[model samples]
Target: MGFHGIAKAVCRALTVRQDGPSLYDVCDPLLLKYQGGDPHLGKFYRTALGNPALRPLLRRTGLPALKDAERLTRLRAALTAARDDAAPDWTAIGTPVAELMDDIDVRHPQPPAAKVTARAPAMADIDRAIRVCGAHLLRSFARNGFIPTYAAFNLLGDADISGREMLMALTGLNARGYKNSTLLFALARIFIAHSPARALINPPWRGIAEPMWEPVQIRHRSAYYDAFFTEALLGFVETGLASSDQAGAARRAISDMVEFCLKTSAEEVPSHDGSTVNVITALAPGPHPRFSRFFAQIKQDLGFGIYVPDCDTTACAFSAATQAGADDPILDQPLVDFYRGYQVRAGANEPRVTVPLNDHIDYEGGVVTWIDNLNGDRPYGNDLDPTLNLDILEVSFRNLKRWKIIETPQRLQTVHRIIAFQRRLVESGAFKNPRSHIYYLPELYSAYFGRCYAAFVALPLAAQRIIDPGNVFALIRARVLGYVKDELIAHEMNPFDAALALMALAHLNAEIATFTPALHCIVQNLGEGGRRGPYKAYEWNKMKTPTRILVGGPEVTSAFALMSLALARRRMAHS
Candidate 1:
């Protein structure tokens, strides 16, 4: 079908904003003609929701939030609403349905810092390690400021600009008072250089340039990376990391990221019987080009095509934007809009999806990875993950309390539900299960969980009570510490994992002795040529392929190592 036909079909499907969009619309005979009646309804579902691996991560019972009778009635009402409300717009734009789907395949489509004092035996050694790692990172920094050393897809090409590792190293160095150093200045300049102030194709955000991380190999700009880079730069400015010359550029880039986050958010209106219906808001990853380029080359690089709105990116964006110092209160809308919206709960309308290598598990309360339920290769973004939920909690709660924003009932309810959900994950041993959180390596997840938990507890008692009501943080803390012990007991962690564990311990303020094992792990794994040892931080399914892609390299490993040693040293001296 052509654009007109597709527009008409969408208009018909969304007869009323109250009833939500209908997947049944894809079953219409007219729509079926486009796919040659291949029973594409299920494909549409899978595409929009997720592949088989992500199917089970959603709430199983009471899905879709509409039964046959109710669905049909709503569909009919939607048709009526289309006839009444959207008819004029369709007539004016003058679009036809059959013309829209002729040749369209809709599938496969943050941080901050600070500084402190230091002191001197074990401390001296830790300081030396930090310097060593810092030098390794500095040596690996591309003249362009990109950390090309971060290997992805099992290859570390000079063209690969790994935003994740770049930001990690930048912040880690800044934490050690390297913010004003020459290396950081060069890196900050790179961020300033890549941020495009020009207008974008999709969502048409203006007034600020979006921070686009163009990984030469992937050849696409990532919204997640954009928000992440923005958040990191914001932290740099906040902590006096960015030099005076770069601070203005950093602020402008942050404004760009905030704009991108707000623009990329998708609004889902659920069908409801009550007089008031709340719209669900969440952030989606983007190639966000204009309509003409939407389907030119379908690259399924991250399993679920391109349009899935995930909690990880959402949380990152929310946290970044909340701290971005925007004058508009609307920037905080996600805080209010995300209430019980995308999370797994009773009566949730989201589609269920699963994760591989650990699929047999069953649990709920954590937020699903994807929140958007549109008809992409993965819609209804299903699946709960410990790290993703923790991310959401860290950002949402911190933002809410940081700004002292008054809580509406919906916002309040969302916070409580997320806490309860995490409690369930922790108490049920889901938090410790590698299969439960498929995105990160086991040790890496432990590190992230510990760090996020530390941040959560650092909040006021009233805020901490949200999770501490059932001693949830206590259990979570124990689980994190237990994992640290396990890593030490095995005494076999790679340098990256060792560094990650050390960072977690430092974040948790564990005793100085707890730092010994991880420090040894780092020392033992040191590369032969005076380089940091090689390690893989995490892996994910490549788009359209079954192959799992690994991402990490010596630069990234050293980055973490630097942060870990630096943090451990500082924390110990303070203690």
Candidate 2:
């Protein structure tokens, strides 16, 4: 579809403000569309920006973009150099991908002070690791009490930025003359704890002694039951139960099928025997229905995060991670391989060129077959094709990043408070549930979560205090720089995750204006370029293909948009 088509769809999908559409509405879809065959949409975008009537409307809507588009262009050249290293020919005067990434990191380096490196899709395990790591830091500080990192009770000191993204953003801060690593490290360390998981792990149950029984953070304490805020954060409260049996049940189910398949694979043709018939049925003649069932079960098992019974609190106040015992049997690889030759192609076709083994597709024919059926043998970079993976790579970093900050910026003691509560549950055997149990999620245990507001606010504040964060005209250049960094990094990421990062970063920027009033200009200046990308029909479809399975989740996208809106409203009111 054309740009207009996407604009029309967006208008239909979201309820724009009574005053007009939000800046997100004005820009997100194109950024969401990012790539594909929609030149008409690009043309419309250019025209809309140029038009006299729409220009102000666009400006008034205010959005984020790169601070230096030209600088970003240079950054992209560096990023390409780095990415090319992903599959470098060492014989051709080249460095490996990892080293090149390090080099690029150095070239566009964020000043070093305190540092932490993390991988994507922050799973449950990472939580505990941080907690354990924090324990070491805490032990050193327990003798003298820990203090909040900011040392500023004034709300004026506040600005939203993710711990990691904001760390990288220090380049902007350094340009403005705030050259203190101790301060940034103190802030960076504080940045780690801003995750929703803290809602559960570090609940203030002692608040129960007060007139209000609910967690201390909630706006309505007495009105809402005890642990209400806890429930709001973690989806449930834990009673300290181990989920070994439920895990065993799921394991047994998979093991039985795996055994049957292993035995069946011994025989050449398919069997009608009952033992081997669990995953296969003669009704469809092909195993597609059976495969569908397998897929469903896999999702169910992994997604089955059970809620534990409440201990003088709301239900689901302390939920446990979906249990999977490592010793528990794994899926039957042989059984999984049964479908490898289910549909043999007539002739041998050369393997399609991809981003060099991007994923180890144990079961290949399926993803490609699905892609080909959607768009036939579109040869490698046929000039018409951008050849991108269409699967959603879900990300969960911002929530996790927000976890460490609950302590005191440096006060990891917040995690200890949470562990104390969990220990009570553990000793009292509150965690003995047959189906769901609350074990000490020592990893996820932290006091607070990291949040992002738009950088629009601080840019001008820094401008006034020391230097021009960016001139009114120069701010867009920075946004362009940011987008190139984001999109280039996204090359290695699944498109879905990439889209999510963009949206999250955009909302973060939008929020910044709330804390610093002058930021709205930065917000208005960068316009859509700060937060958007070129949306095209083909690219949208490819990205959406994986999203279709999860498409019913409008909640995720809407929540993100709401965050951006919250930031916008806050900024507007203050401005």
Instruction: Write down the TM-score of every candidate.
Output: 0.54, 0.18
Clashes of 1: 28
Tens digits of per-residue lDDT, candidate 1, 92-182, equal 2111111221222111000111111132235555555555554443343323233332212311111112233222222322111121111
lDDT of 2: 0.22
Instruction: Give all candidates' CA lDDT scores.
Output: 0.44, 0.22
Query: Can you write out model 2's per-residue Cα lDDT over 461-499, one digit (the tens) per residue?
Result: 532222222232133323432432333232332222223
lDDT of 2 at 52: 48
Off by over 4 Å in 2: 1-323, 326-330, 333-336, 342-346, 349-575
lDDT, model 2, position 367: 15
Residue 348 CA displacement from its true place in model 2, Å: 3.6
